[model samples]
Target: MTPVLVALEAFHVLRPLWLGALVPIAALWWMVRARRAHRAAPRDGLAPHLRDALTVGSDGQRRVMPIDMVCVALALLAFGASGPTWSRQPDPFVAQSAPLVAALKVTPSMTADDIAPSRLERGKQKIRDLLELRAGARTALIAYAGTAHVAVPMTEDPGVMLPYLAGLDPAVMPEEGDRPGLALDSAQALLSRETGPGAVLFVTDGLDPDDVPALSAANVIILSLLPEGQGDRGLEAVSDVPVIAVTADGADVAQIDRLLDAAQARALLDDDRQPWLDRGPWLALPAALLMLLWFRRGWTMRWVLMVAAFLLTQPASQARADGIADWFFTPDQRGRLAFDRGDFRVASEAFSDPLWRGYALYRDGQYADAAEVLSRVETAQAAFIQGMAYLRSRSYRDGVRAFETALLRDPDYPNAAENLETARAIVAYVEEAQEQSDTGEDRGIGADDVVFDNESGKGEETVISVPEDGADALLSADQWMTTVDTRTGDFLKSRFALEQNRPAPSAEADAPDGDEPREDSSQSQAPELAE
Candidate 1:
């Protein structure tokens, strides 16, 4: 279980280390040969028929004895030297004693009839279940609608937290908008009050962006409560924190099991402090016994049995090939085909497997990974694949460099020049885009409305307007407006007041009426943003 034990177990597999073991085998062979030659000399003068005969002398020496025993002993010695082992690891049943923090989301559309009992209600039920499952651990509950507010501070008894959570409804927080990032920050702050290694369970419909990176950085595990048919749509992250998923629409037990399996996989990778036993000593014993028997039974029919045992005990070389393939195409190989077809998502999933991660990254505009994958390739096709990955990832400089290097080895190559040009174009585009976005003057803010809160009473009335035809372009253009204020910004109090009055305008405009209101043509909200 200790680090030293693990290191020692791994060291036994080293060729140089195993070679030292061969010393004992060599000594055994030398001793056996000396004994055999001495025994054979006395029997040489006997008749040819009797020379090979088995005999029991009055001095208690036996000949032509049990070959099976000798073979079995040799096999044991060989097996011991090879260091076979079995580990009886402890059951991972003990639970953590740390307190937990739960962040529950209550959004406006949570009242949608799509889910039975509503998404918010069902989420509360699951949280209740999770709390019941947590033994006596303390937990805090946070309820957020448009914004977040702590429902229950950390408490050891779920019973104490249940009443506070029971009062939770969509109306608990003012209807501003769902912002999981802010909610997560509040939950994290609540969790910081507890002692020991605490965790957070954020149960939300995927209203949030891929918060995996942020949540993981916060050292909080995320358990996504996706509605049925929802999957990670557009997210990219390399997070150490584990994510478990459960569907709102009665998730199949199999899906839960998969989630658990994923969690376990992540734990194995991240929880290095977990115990692992040394199995080397157990294996060495049998290998030593097998080698002893191998010496006792000189080239005989018993080798057939030894071969069978070896075949049964040791996996064939083909297994290594299959392992490579599995690592490359884990869960599915849809990603590789998708990458080939220019589908980035599938390629990304396929890249999750270590074997293909590099390739996936390359196809997804990750040139660094492509170069790494290309470096690992052993075949000509791999070199070409690596080159293409580099090209697609927009590493035109690297792609051109790689192509030139490969061409020197094989002239008149196919497809290299075409990829080279593509990479060059991507490089040009990247440079241009970078320059365009960076230049202060190039970003046209005149077309973009500069909304300013007139807190500072500057007494000049200036009418700076654009033509109606160019109004949209002006609004859409990149612009930054400076604000002059004596007070530090605080929107929460104003937002709370607005929510209480129900004065928030509907995202969709009613009819355009001169008396009703002048539509802010410059500040139009997107349809989804209205939600």
Candidate 2:
């Protein structure tokens, strides 16, 4: 549904009982206004010009009074208390930037240098840039010529997708054809595995008009690698799908980012699991702003202001109890003062509100206590803070859980999903390492027992050196991935051939005479990635 319709449908107050307060406030305001208007009515004994001169103020009817401001503010507070809401909150589990399956055409035409070094090369550059723009978002890659194959699965790591993206080429494909529809379908299939909202991006030199319906049906956007005037005929048919042409700068990537954000928002708005967003509190801001007018010379409540100032100026010491300040300031008020002064430990002890107390504890370097305390406050930011505390305490599993919960509450919570992924990865790595090292040999952090990991190039050179043909010089998986022991062209060729030669399921099940099922000829190589 359109946003306007959705808002109209969802518009309702959460605490409708609070709206009753507006009635009394409105009546009082009306009565006072009528009484003032009655008193302001001109006396029949006075002349018109003389009465005009005697009038002290300009047009009482049009003038706004302090009473009006108070009534408006009270009405706003009442509406706010009623908890007015119009839209559901987005699903917190969904990533802020939606998952994307990017399909790049690997046809010979992509190698054409009409635009630059090559259309294919430029497309790769665009994908690389887009990955940077969508750093924490899950992304997959596909290559299609005569057919389509998943080069990379959904992953947050741009590192994983880049190598496979650079490997795609026309020569690697077993067959040669412009089958964008196949590529689009493959991308859609990959995206279907994900539970949250996602989009499909087709990076191609040209598209077939026949494929327009498929693209239009899905959340798909096209990045045309062809020059401005070259691919108009095919692209003109793409009336529904957004077709973004190649740009000299980063404009194409920016446009793609905007499209992705918009698609994600659209999908989130339709999600039934999302909660209603509380819009009532937003009304308080205008009310508070309007009430600022009461601080004017005559409108000021001098005694009330003085009393407030006295309370705010009280000593911030958290240890003080039953003193004059204690009678004046609440524990939270004192805690706030202490917190503002950077006495976090004092603030942590003094704070009565669980949320504020947890924040103060976190600031005081009591992470475990902070995490435990923050659990009581069920909010996205609270959960996020708690997650950080867990990570800080080396509780990876707990950290992951906290981050996930935070995302479930608010998907747009900054860096929550990314941190959750990192925590999960760390936990997995630790578990795997422990399982592999189950020999139960004792290890220590001694000079000889210092195992190195995640080492950069120059740093690795300084620690240990191995001769080229040493017996123990077996290349690790990480070493092989970075250095590329196998040729990209050879790998793609074998995989493409395996998939192409695989028999169709229907052909295998139904023999010509319907006597028996046919056996597959290409049984040696399965059409699957060798993980």
Candidate 3:
């Protein structure tokens, strides 16, 4: 198709409802204009001379510019603000194939020549076919005789599984029994690392009815290589899963193809697919240029200026009523830009939106401020962030409270429970340290004494004693506390200072103050408490 035709075909309006609202606005405008004209008409009983004096400056001539021009401009502005869009361009798909584990039975029963080749060899062939059909899928192979063992770990390359398939022998198995349950368990273990949908394909003669429920949690597909007379009715009765039985002559290859097709369709349907691109902003430039033409000095310019001023002066919440702010830089968008550049102070100031202001403060290392800001929001995410802020600021009791609140809001919130335990441990240690200081036993402290290595899951304790020299030993015990506290406080205080002193946002010139606000000396003090 021609480019123009294609563009025309793709064109669509995002907010058609806004266009409907324009009808009532136009009607109101017309009614107000008529009312003004009617009120300005001279009284019927007035003398001609008196009327002439009252209308002294009136030229009795029509306006040079028609009111229709203003109406047309308003209509164009409305259409542009409604978000006109066109031309969908396809984005590259990030294909994610579900992991598949093929569990093959290596018992003596698999050696029976029910198929043209032995049952074991046929089962191996089917597994190879499945891997080839599911190209790019993460696959694993498990061999089972008495117990199950992972013959191959999960890998994208199907060829890695071929070596293990050829090496499968019943004699190699240390025990002899049919335990499909153990094989399913091994498959689940292999798939635990993967975060996508998973399936377990059983290539065996049959499975125990009781063991079928264990594989019910995952997608299960059974490929039976039993003899023609040995149907899979018993297995089907217990498990509501797909079972494809292959004879010695291999008459059910088409059924295998159908099953593979269905599986691929399901995967594509459930995967997280990206949405179409929005082209609404492409129309904004033309709309702006058209409005600029109406800025000529005249009554038309005066009317346009009045409308523009009214829109600009409206409060932020009211501006969003007509989506006017959507066409300009929103506070959240400005905050995100500043945050990305690591200018968190400016980001916090820019984020007038209550939802994101707390996060900006947290990133700025204003932990106490962040906790206060987030308390009002009171969502699971807000509570979690508040917990982190409190914890980093050495408010262990408050941190525990915030984390518990987060868990109450959402029991499955990640890391809330773990961090709560850490906070409790810190609180206990703080009490212990206070007791020791009161008893005059351990006056000096080391860096390891205060900091807990949560990542390594261990705490280091190291205390430095005072020298036995006569003059140094005579110093008060309180002096030792001051010296040790300074060393530990330096770590956090320096990091806080570094964060506070980052360069201002790139668009600082456009801010209300035209520059970043300077901090006073009083605001730079570091606390003596341990962190």
Candidate 4:
């Protein structure tokens, strides 16, 4: 079938109920109009004057053209509002087959003419055959002589490795002897970042003693290109790994096919496969044109203009709820607006984008949750935000690590160097505090040990003890106070005074004549916690 026909066949409505209801209602409306026109007809035997009087005010009968036009316009509008779609959308999390690494030996021995062509030429042909057979799998190419090097990184398209494979030679290597072990290590390094199951295909005539240990630990298929009678005894002795031997003269296609089948079996499974293109929104243009044509009849244009105005002014969430807006204005847009307004909790809940959600959680003082969300995102901003979250949660070691990662991504990242220094200072403070608490030393107040409640009329002081087990609890308590009231920090400082063997400051003493005390200008400002 043609492409247009295929798309038309796939066309479906998101809201079919609107069209279904309109059909029956239109039929009922036409029947009722027909009956009313029949009843209003003049009687055959009526007097001329009476008939003239009855028919004078009436236009002979209602025109079917106007009613038909109205019904057709309404039907078109209903179809347009139903949301027609024809193609599938691409999803980022779609599963894929495991990547394959081809470790080809490029030593001087491969230049031998055992077959009609050289062994190296025949080996390249076999690699091409394997790639064609496993079309969906991502492939990487590695060349090894004395040292191994990656010629092509892992990619879904196998054609990328073909050019590099054509020029591969032993002269490119710095060292001289066969070292297939290094090639296997290079393949492993390439696959380390991938979470899926993978296979290492070792294409060589023979293996060295050192290569056997690395081959034992890997899921490998050793392809031997020796002549019929000559068998590598070292490979035959190793029973743990699977080996596929193909003689130069009699290289059967079936043997290579079996090798590919084994590689695919060892690879990862895929899920929720979908087409890459989404052609649903293409229908909107034609639907809009049809609506414009209907507006040539007066008053319809005004209605359309009013609807456009309402949608433009309405909040995205309300527009979506009322079915006036589509996926174009999604929850992520709403979350960004909420974040700008300083509604962190609302922004966190509204955001579908993972990066924005993590940032919102950090702003809401949910540090542990923020760290968990930010860990999946690999960006300098995400690392910096994660470091701030860790620092606020009293995890100084983790904070230091996160800051170091941010600086590595961008050395001139704003505030990263300063935060790193502050994180180190906090680490030292935590260690010193732990030692002091352990030895029970300095019961007498020091400069850092106490915070005086100057607003308290009784001149009470609060001791700030950094207990090993109570760090998270103290942070939680501080967060709760900040959430309840902006000026609760001093109240908490005074409340801690009661725990330090000092007299509790009464509410009456803090406020004279039963009125609240004057707010301190310095206390109203946010404290610099990074230092």
Candidate 5:
């Protein structure tokens, strides 16, 4: 959806009743105008010269009056009170910006040097610029040639996405063809799993004519990697999707940003769970300027000054007592403001909500208090926080139990399994050390706070949990994950090959001939590179 269409669909008044005030205001203006006209009526049979002499100014009859200003100001205020809005608040659990999935074309054509370094490198740079523009927003990467695959999963950290993005190569793809249709499907699948609506960005030089159908169906925005004045003729057929031509400057990326915002606005409008965002305050600006005219000579009213004085003095008095903050913000709201500013200690002090308070406490390094507060919350995220709190406090057993609870509640909770294993290993290491120590008391450095010593010098050679070179045997599921020496191209090739070889339910029906021996599926294959 474009922003114009979204605004057209979403623009509405929250408090429609306030508009009724306009009726009386209009009537009052008309009555005042009629009364003034009657009072200013020329005397019966008066000469034109005498009438002109009686008027102090030539255009006095047409000059703006106090009633006109009052009516306009009141009308503006009434319109503002109606609470006009065209967008809503962002999802509380998600960032203000929408999630984005960038589907990049890793093909031989993208390596062409029509412009600068190459189309592929330029696309990569554009993606980097986009990441900078949309920091803290979740984004994913997809690479497509003959088939599409996720190069990187959705993540808020640009560092994680950038490494995989840089590693993508046309040679890494399992097959060779421009299959953006498949890429769109992959992008959709990734977005389908998101809690809120997201947008897909296609960074490619051109698209196959047949791919237009798939492109037309979705709200994908295309960042044309093709040089200026050059484009895929097939894309002109796409009516709904916006194709932003590549620019040397940031204009193209700015268009992509707008499309992403439109997606978020659409989500806000469609979700009944959230309320329409009130934009009533925007109307106050014009109304305020109109009221300023009342300060002129012969127009100043005692009530206006009284109201202005009261509004001004009231805030100072409220500031002294903090009553204004109390009136405008809840405790949790204040805590969230503080939390966003990195003042976790103040956030912890202000938060009455157990989860936020506990999280704030944890960030502030009050792990003991965090664990105690978080234990009252039953959610998986709360359990995860509590578990980390325990780990920080050197309560390995408690940390293990908390992690186990989190896994039981939500097995997919990120990093929960790895932390659980670490806690368990620490506990095991402590027990083993206790058994080996001759004094039967902790004496030397162990994991975290646990210590063991060989005072007797009789204990067998002790095994360390993780090596000094930074092995994750004490943490993650697979210790070899960090040790893998395989290049990203090789890793992606193997991953895509596995998917390509997997049997599909419609394999026989879709194949040209089920009885014939299977041949190579790649439309074009690059020569194998030497290791």
Candidate 6:
């Protein structure tokens, strides 16, 4: 049932609050003016029949025109013209949050040719679909290679996990093995201990060594995504961790059942499942049609001056809607939604907008600029983003600081806390590595550190040298000969020269034929000129 409200939103139509006050004042002023005019005018004598007819009494009857009622009706019309409208909405319903976890395998086999584009990409697509389907669920992302890394901690936003998944390169960590046990342990770490209701989905090419016991021990619902056609037949499990085996192409019944069995995850086909009746078609279509008909009839205009008032009130309406919409929706999110609906260019523009310029800078490894832009975002989600930007920028100190700030604002903020710990660990690891490198240890930053370069065609490399204190001398010497672009490297060379107390070139040589020769030079013997 819809109840009518006076719709204070109409007041928004009045440009200025004081202008509304003028309504009563104008009426009073007009009344005073009429009284004065009546006092000044002289009354002329008239015949009884003539006076009776003029008095609205041609039949010898006198009556007063309901002027007060007429004035009231006019006032009501003016107010209605102020664009009064009723907002009809259905009864409020409670929304419940679902618990969800996405476990992605970062195994080397995932890069195999069995899947088109690769098993990892296919897994990411499936996970994206699952995330979209479970909109309001608390989600987490765990990436398992030789070891497991919590790509994203458990939280409400599943979208943030998208980039970490997308940017995954097998070459980043040595041709590392995929450890399912480590992945399960990480997944279990993310779940709430009190309630084992969380669902864990494993997206892999069924190549990881079986860790069915760990999976079962963690009470994780394992939904295994296998290569197309082939199932997880040989990939036997040590424990009965119900495996929901699905084709690499898409999610299937086999996959769903396995997932459900593993974690006791919710299944739609089950009789215990409660369905949400989609009344959208029933309500939305009829409401839209009714609105169209109502607008076409134009009867609402008689009592409400909506059309006329809307033109006068649009400025305020647009402002309010924009302010609120901008706060709740990020440009990237809006653009992605549009992209999902097939508006590619529009979505791309939104994602590439200046507002999110920091993210682009961060992606390019310019951490400082990223930190600046991300810092402006005050929400927990933004803080989490800023933390990532800082971490990628190699500003672990700043990244940790940002995560700490986020924790203060939202103690249980999922991604921030996990990354905060990671950032701290990274800082400590780097310090220890630097110490080791200083002591004559020829090892690289870490035993498994990997750096990949797709653009230069250098897949990945491990830097094993403890770069000499003056390593720049060698690179700069080569750069001086124009062997490489030394734009910033030149600046570093100049700075090093300054630190060494190198003297500036002689003024005479730097004069460029613009300065005068010294008179003292004439007293000295003339030097021989080159032939």
TM-scores for every predicted model? 0.34, 0.60, 0.36, 0.34, 0.69, 0.33
RMSD in angstroms between candidate 5 and the native structure over all alpha carbons? 10.8
| Candidate 2 local lDDT, 71-106, one digit each (tens) | 888899999999988766642223456788888989
Comparing 3 with 5 on lDDT, the higher-scoring candidate is 5
Worst 10 residues of 2 by lDDT: 518-527
Sort the candidates on TM-score, descending order.
5, 2, 3, 1, 4, 6
lDDT agreement of model 1 with the native: 0.50
Which segments of model 6 are wrong by more than 4 Å?
Answer: 1-197, 200-288, 294-333, 336-369, 377-384, 403-425, 439-531
Over 128-162, each residue of candidate 6 has an lDDT whose tens digit, in order, gives: 77766655346777666665555556554566667
lDDT of 5 by residue, 1-531 (tens): 678888988788999999999999999888877776667645678888898777664454487888888889889889989999888764333355787889999999999999788999999999999998887677888889888887776676789777778888888888999889888877887776555678889998887778888887887888888776676777777677888888899988888887888777776677676667788887778888988888789887666788888888864533322667766578888988887565789999989999889988976789999999999999887887788778777777888889899889988776677778867777776667756654544334544433443233344443334445654335433545876788877877787677677775121221122121111111111100000
Q: What's the TM for model 6? A: 0.33
CA RMSD of each candidate after superposition? 21.2, 12.5, 22.2, 23.7, 10.8, 23.8
lDDT of the candidates, in the order given: 0.50, 0.73, 0.63, 0.62, 0.75, 0.49
> Residue 343 of model 1: what lDDT?
56
Worst 10 residues of 3 by lDDT: 519-528
| Candidate 4, residue 172: lDDT | 56
Spell out the clash pairs found in candidate 6: 221-263, 243-258, 244-255, 244-258, 244-259, 245-255
Model 3 per-residue lDDT tens digits across residues 471-501: 7564446666666644322442343234334
Report the C-alpha lDDT of model 1 over 147-254, residue by residue, as the tens digit.
665566666567977766666666556765766666676666665533334556666665444655676576454555555666653122524655555554444323
- Which window of 10 residues has the lowest lDDT sum in candidate 5? 522-531
Candidate 1 Cα misplacement greater than 4 A, ranges: 1-99, 208-213, 230-243, 248-531
What does candidate 6 score in Cα RMSD to the true structure?
Answer: 23.8
